[model samples]
Target: MYHKKMKSKVVRITCIGLSILTLAFVSILIYSFYGSKKTIQPDALLHQYMANINDGKYEEMYTLLSEQSQAIVSQEDFILKNQKIYEGIEGKNLTIKITKIDELGKTQILVSYDTYMDTLAGDISFSNEAYFTKNDNKEYRLLWQPQLIFPMLNPDDKVRVNTLKAERGDILDRNGEVIVGKGIASSIGLVPGKMSDSKELDIARVSELLDIPVDHINKALNATYVKDDTFVPLKKIPKDQQELEEALLEVPGIKISDIAVRVYPFGEKTSHLTGYIQNINAEELKKLKEQNYNANSIIGKSGLEKIFEDRIRAIDGYEIIVVDSSGEKKETLAKMSPKDGETLKLTIDAQIQSVLYDQFREDKSCSVAINPKTGEVLALVSTPTFDSNDFVLGMSTDKWNVLNADTNKPLFNRFKVALCPGSCFKPIIGAIGLTTEVIKPSDNYESSGLSWQKDGSWGEYKVTTLKEYGDQVNLQNALVYSDNIYFAKAALNIGGDLLAEQLTNIGFQETIPFELGMYPSSFSNTGTFDTEIQLADSGYGQAQILINPLHMASIYSAFVNDGNMIKPYLIYKESTVPEYWKEQVFTKEAAQIVRNDLIQVIENGTGSDAKIDSLTLAGKTGTAEIKQSKDDHEGTELGWFSLFTVDEHTENPILVITMVEDVKERGGSHYVIQKVKTVFEKR
Candidate 1:
């Protein structure tokens, strides 16, 4: 019985020994699997290394490299190389992916990856290969090489930016004439490096040929920053002046090239309408960067140039090139072609514009003419004009300052502002009286050379008529005689509030919807009449009233266009459909009656001096008084003549408005009459 019990104890000890052996085998397999995933696999090591690169963790990426790679590239060198490549790739997105991994040998692994990047050139994809070597500690490490960044990257490779310049579009007139264009011009200059003649003698000879001051030539040649290789421009010459160019070439150190310049065939005549372009300043660059503008770009500075900037601006292109460290070109990675801007065509009659400009050459005046039926602005003239080519070609600081300080205001656009309308506004009151049923066409009022009005709310005032018109006149005869006393009483009967509302409805104190900037017509009275004198004075266009020439011309255009005032436009591209007032400003019947009275004014009244042959003309004459000094009571006057003519051959009326300032000395109505007549006769 003792022997049997000992055998059972031996059996239990053997079972326990087998259980411990099985557990030991399972633990060894678990350890082997964990080590392979964490350190043995090349993909795991490569992924960790690339993660650091993606995060811009250069120092960490350097630590993951093999010992041999660390010997070849220092951490500082690695960081600098990567940073330069990253900076050159501006506006690009980068992403990385492990493509493939293969076991090469007992201690080496081949790793393949793809870099997907979005560059300005376009979406780009390329693959690269890396080898991870296992160290004595059984840890895999990445082998560093420049090709790891890009499959085609070389040790000496660098980046270069090439700008592809775009050509600006041309501006054309209605007759298909080139108003503004990129023309060939020669700049007379000297390359200091190539100059072998005496510096002083050469400068003297150059100054003589170019018709420039000797001091200017000396200053440019002796400038501190003027390098030996620098090309110093003395003056600009026309490319076609071969004789003058040959004469200048006799002087040593002279150089010339056919460079691009903004040329205007009719410079000063179309300056205000065509505008000009100039190199953008720092302040302008900041606001235009989003539009792909560069610091070296030129842009429109004023007038139509500023209004249609985007359409005329060029779209620049670029090329991404790979170069060596010494700035040697290696390969072109990507390229983009430049796109030229759209051509802009205008509705300007260059011949008519030139005539109007010639007539107003000596006077400080504003004149505008439009086709009443179509709202095609044929001519817009403002006197004391500046040569726009001066701004574009390059103006001296002194000359620019002189232009700004000129009393005549050569740079100021006169048609854009408001001025007193004088008796020219009488038609507006007549229209209001007729449309609002304030008076009938046959209504007559007793009038003399003068009349007086006294209001309880305001004070007493007097309105005097022109010496020509007598008493007891109807609307037609009153307009022909310009009877102020008659119109004043009519305005008082119509009330100021109604008159102000009518003016507002016709675009007073409101935007005129023109391409060029325009100031709104303005008046003080918004609601009710302050006094009968105020209404009467306003009715005659003498009570703090201001109206732009364009606005007045448009209003009268409605009278000729069957009570429809089409919006004025200059660009043909944007004016496909005619835009006019939604609500009619006058009835067709009222317009006809007013039109007949205007005809009488030209036929037998104040505007008779402006009569022309072969046409039935209609118009109004005005003389707005302006106090010379605020303290002085006596003032000069601004003479105005607004007229339109209709011929049997034409369906549209040719309308014009001319304003001549300081007209008392300049021959009031007669001066404006001759000016308008000269333009029409030229037409």
Candidate 2:
């Protein structure tokens, strides 16, 4: 029995031993397959690191670092360092492309990657290598260092950024004369040691003269860095304010130094043309983001300064570099050279503009002067002008409000706008009548005192003239007498369709092709005359006709240019050539007939007051009434005078159109004619 039990025990032990071996073999196979999988590829580890960076998961990236790297940099320090450097340059769109994974041995790798990112300086791209190793747990890990962020980064290295300011451009006139140019402004300041016995009194006097506050001056003088010898600046005044400067110089302790400033030589005279510049606002920055404009940028506010902003503005440059502890540049990472703004030359005569402005200062008026022979614009002036320099030098809120609230509309730009042309449009009607042969130059008509109409169909409306001359009047005689009845009859005979067609062909109800914004001339609010009464009134320049003064100047040129109208241009280029706005707008015969009559109108008619001494001048006078109805006798009136020198009596061949509002009580068209005469006499 003992022998049999021993045999059974041996068999049992052998079977149990075999089962243990089978389980051990299966466990070995499973461990071998998973352990190999746990060892991450070098490229795969690099891709994961980059993905964490792209997601801004810097903590995860720190965990991917090798044990030696973790000891070198803490998780908090690593995250903060990466955050500061990347955000310092406004970096975005980070990408890392693993180009190659080199295996140094079984546990280490040298992975090369191409890094790219966009920043404020533009785009940055560079190639670098990432060192990686397997940790004790057999997982791949990065051997991190500061140099991993930037290939050139070292322990003491620093990223430096700087800006190169772009210089502003100048505004030049036709003769290369500086209009808006660089000049000096008096930097008003005081030396603490040089102050007189009455230091407080002197400072107070300066404050008043500069239109500055006493508190501001006191704060500047009391600044922490101020010394007895330091000249702490308080304010900047225009250099040309001689009287004010002299008064301030009389006060003790005041020291005036010259500082560079933007100058408008003509001051209030050219304010409407040059406009001004100011610091960019939040709304403007939002709209100009794609153009790289920032909060510190300066922008043109109005007029030509605003119109050609891109051409006139400076393009700033930038530099990204590495610097040492002492702030010395070690290497230039990226740099862009500054591009100075381009100077723009205009077809403007400074003298002419100044003279025209002087004449209209007291009155609400506007004028435009053009060189009829070359199509070059000479002058544009508006009355009650404000100083553009005030905008740059900083205007007080009270002063700005005064200008904004003025009844004369000093801020309004009237030169490029449309207004009633009055009798100044008579010559155009006569020219068109002769061109289409709708009315003959010699055709005579009978005048009916001061008022007349087509028939009973005209209802309460009647055509009226200031005066009648003879029983029978020819076209020239009617034009000379300023007869509205004669032209009204002619318009009735021509019919509305043909007259409207003729007006449209003459460039009416269309925008003038010019650089500046010119409101188009229109026949009426709805762009058409609804009745014969409306049509007749339009023919005599009294209905709903509104023409831009610039367009009017261009149109009148046709009468003198052998039926060709000169194209008005503002910008002056070296290769400029004279061009025509309209060729053959009238037959030579038609243009000549109207031209001769205009000369007569100046010589003996309503325009006689505008004739300059020793000059062969031709002109027309217009007084357009703004009334509710034809029978309404009381309303405001706009006075106009269109004049041109027919001969070389002046240095330049000039054509001017001057208009003044509220001339009804004043001499009507005669008032505007006198203003033109004064402007011409000044030349």
Candidate 3:
């Protein structure tokens, strides 16, 4: 009985231990099952997916989409769509922030997020909703929806982007008349593909009709990438030439096509001021690519047209269009309207510019007129100018080569650069002498047509006058006669450093604030006067000095405006403030004295030919000798005439300056003087 009782107790203990171990194992198994089955939060999945998209990881973004969405749109298509939208944007970034989350069902969640991107227009902001569903695999996936790509997109519609360019602005004159704008012209050419296979037949026919060499046509046809269908422009034909069009059409593959081209109604009259436009070159296109310029873009090549290019260029618009599979436009999704460029009004008087330009019909010369008080450039003309229309409408290679090879250099802007001022520089020196206390109006210097300093200080320092004066000459008579001896001796008294300071004070070697930049006029101001002869020569506008017509005219305006130099300008803007250097280069009294001397020039001195009837005029004449070389003492002459007269209507002094180069066959300064008078008489 005792043995049986002990065995029963052991059995009871073993059963209790096995029961405890079983309970522990079952608890662990239950915890593992619940942890593995927990659903992923919809908010977390949506945030991660948006983050991938913003990082430009479109491929990763595609992987997070539900199986339903991936079936319709492939990862490659999604990437391409994103790339097209971001192509032209400079620095692109997309910001997404979750604002709210709505629970639709036990496994579906809708997330609302704010989308933001900065664009040229401004900050572009919008709200979008992404739907997420817990898939059978127990992980949340983004449901493919129309709003997933863009807030306004639809499932069946295609996204298309169209670039719309604004119409380029019109360049207008002071009177608001269009000076440069769009117009139609004819381009004569043969479609390379349409031409006959026999080179001889096609080349001969084209050369005969266009007056081009057969060899030239053959060369052009054989150029690299000369496809058969490409239109190779042979020449620009006149739009009115219907007969020439018919004649050209008779040739196989030869045709006339109308193309939009820049038109300049005034043509050569405004060539220098308005400039011209041409197709962008490789180098220019590269530099302008960031500005949306392309290979086919027409850009300003010279003058103000180039200077104000950015302001005159139109803004480009864009459209989001939906197209069918065949690439046919089906519907417009969104559009941003294009804006035309603003109208640029200039300070130029077209009528006056036209009249002045015609006056120098065949002469190679330059003339500039300005309003002294207002600083308005009324007229600027560089004669022997080529018609801008030739470039705008297009020219043959033969005509272009001839113009460039011509010795006359009609393409050069003579008004921006030229030789010395000649006697027209007298007033500048006279003013310098009086202001520096070097000489007085009352002080008389000996002028017997020639003066020589025998002192060994200046080797071969001799001065001569335009004409013989009496034994003595004062400031008045020196200017009236333009006596070189009187002015030279006066310049020697001030020395080089002081004279240079005065020249700098009066706008010499300074940057003039004009759109069409001016070449800096140089002076012999190295702070070293090697010989008195150099100073003496400079006093008469000879020696090492170079001046442009624009700068010379601007300096003379100071004389007319009581020693104030106003900045010259071309464009007119209401917001543009007037700019001027007001330091007293010369006193009011000295300016009046110079004015009287100038008037005496027209009345009794070298510029007498410029005297106009019933017009009170103050003027000066100058003739400068340009040495053929350092050793060639006999030089060509450059004639100059500067005049200022008060306008009858405005009561402001109107200053006109004319310069003629290589005047060997001309009438000297008198020729320029008459040109000025002719311009004034028209007024």
Candidate 4:
């Protein structure tokens, strides 16, 4: 009886325990399917909405709005407002963080967030609240408002931008005189009140004088801003166009007024150096949009204006204001003060520049003058140039077409370009020979006539010299005579490998140490001299040896500067000093030997035409043939003359190198020598 009672009690206890386990499993399944969703929906929906705003997806944001918010503001209006306020300020690099989410009620929630973005005016960071609500559809939606775009924004408020333009800096010379400065320009326009009875006749005459089309003037006259007494500006002309001003005044309806403009006082004389400013094109505007540039901004288009643009360009300031419906300022969101551009002073002498240009204005020529002792650039001139004022005021298509079609290439900049140096390069080889000790100053070579080849295997190839000065020639006589055969034999003595090594060590086929960009003086096109004939020809600057006009002048400084080439510069600073470009280029003894011979070259040799009674000069003259081969006769010739003042009495000593095209029948180097002599004598 006792065992049966114990078994019944155990069975009851087991049944009660199984019932409790079953109930717990059912409760967990209910929570997983429905309870958890209610807790996660609001936060996930809020996160997705915030992500949409950061990505600039305004349409998706509109879809996320609550029903009442959607009805109050239509989708199109919301999208436009978002796009304008976002893009108008040029916003970028956006980031948003949700700081907290709190429940206001079962259907409404308040979310705290921080927003940050970069704008054109400056950076913006703010904290705001996002209200989210659940509707009858049981889905969370945003409660949108103008405050969502900006915390302080309202329905009638406008995002206004105010720009304060900076004044462009002037470009000055070494003496602090302006090369480009603020000057007056004439505004050519029409006065409706002064129109004559024959208005068409007057308009046609004005149009012809100003080179503006008839339709352009008509459009300006018919503009909505035009009035019976208003001056309808048609075009701008140089202030000094007195002849045109007189002609236009005769046309009854024409009126002239003065306006401020960036003027080039030297006009075409310094156009290649100062360059010119013009309206910024589409490509430049797009590239510089981030720097506060607009369609109305003026930018440098060429020359120094283009090269040193960052230093001369103005820093335009901006203000972002919150304006009312009546266009009254309510608040300023961001502000920056206008900063003017900095001035650029150069080591240019305006007097020397003017002199060089005026002498070569009618010829295809290039000139570079520098202080050999200081390496300060005195003058740079390229002739047959177009006026920079034309570019500044305005340019007609016909005028541009004429300049482009001209065979002389007036638009091209010739200073930085490289050309064959001809016999003028003999001094460099002589210096190299002296440095290598392969050719002594008195070592003599038997003359091999005007032309000779290295060996019999080479056919129809020969190295030639201008004149055979002596039967037995040494280094000094070879340089003065520009004897190609002697240097050719000297180069053979140095061998092909050591000659190239020495040339490269002296900065051949390398970037010049100058602020201005220039093509390097190189030994050959392929960077190596392949044949003995080619190497021999290269010794006298014939076989693929080309040198920039500026660099050629710089190279001569080594002789006078204690065997160190001074680094050349254009822009001048107060603390700037003469720095060495290449040291130990030649021994001090070798330099003196070459220098003495150059003085004799001016006094008694080929360059005697450059002699003057009042001043002593040392120089070299060369005539380079632009032919396919040594004997090709149809090709044109280039005349070159490089000279420097050698006397101790000279005050402002200068080394001037000039080259002119098409001197074949015009006396060759003699023509250039006389021209250079005239320049010195005039000064």
Off by over 4 Å in 4: 1-56, 66-76, 99-112, 129-144, 187-206, 214-234, 245-260, 279-299, 446-472, 647-650
Tens digit per residue, CA lDDT, model 4, 1-683: 88998999888998888888888888889878766666435556666766776688989978889999999999999999988888787777777788898999789998888888777678878888888888786778889899887788889998987887788888888888788878999988999888999988888888899998888888888899888899998888987789989999998878899988899888887899888999889999999987778788889988888888888888788888888889888888777778888888889888788888877888899999888877888888998898998888888878999999999999988887899888788888888889889878989898888988788877877877778876668887887887888878888888889888988887888899786678888888788889888788878777788998888877888878767776788887776466878888888888778888898899888899888988878888888878997678899888889999866568877889999888899988778887787768877
Give the alpha carbon lDDT tens digit for every residue of 1-683 in model 3.
89999999999999998998899888889878865577667777777766665577778878888887788888888677655554433224667788999999888889988877643333456788988887777688988775665676565556666678787778887787778877778998777777666757767877877777887776777789678787777777657778878888877777688987668878888898888888889999989877767666778889877888888876677676556666777766456677777668887778778877887757778888887767778788888888888887767778899889988888988777746887888898888888777878898876545565636766554565657767658888888888877778778887888988888787677776787887777676564455667777888888876777777777777776777676788877665344665456787777778888899988888888878877888889888878854356667888888988843464545788888877766777777777778877777
Judging by lDDT, tell me the better candidate of 2 and 3: 2
Better of 1 and 4 by lDDT: 4
Q: Model 3 misses residue 188 by how many Å? A: 5.1
User: Root-mean-square deviation of each candidate, in angstroms?
Assistant: 7.9, 5.4, 6.8, 7.4
lDDT of 1 by residue, 561-628 (tens): 66766688777655445567524788887777899889989999889987876778999999887875
TM-score of 4: 0.84
lDDT of each: 0.79, 0.84, 0.76, 0.84
Q: Candidate 2 at 571: error in angstroms?
A: 1.5
Query: Which pairs, if any, clash in model 2?
Result: none
What is residue 262's positional error in candidate 2, in angstroms? 3.3
**Model 1 segments more than 4 A misplaced:** 1-91, 95-125, 129-150, 155-159, 194-230, 233-251, 322-332, 454-460, 525-531, 573-578, 628-634
Sum up the clashes in candidate 2.
0
Native-referenced Cα lDDT, model 4: 0.84
The sequence of per-residue lDDT tens digits that candidate 2 reaches over residues 130-153 is 998988777889999887878888
Error of 4 at 76 (Å): 4.2
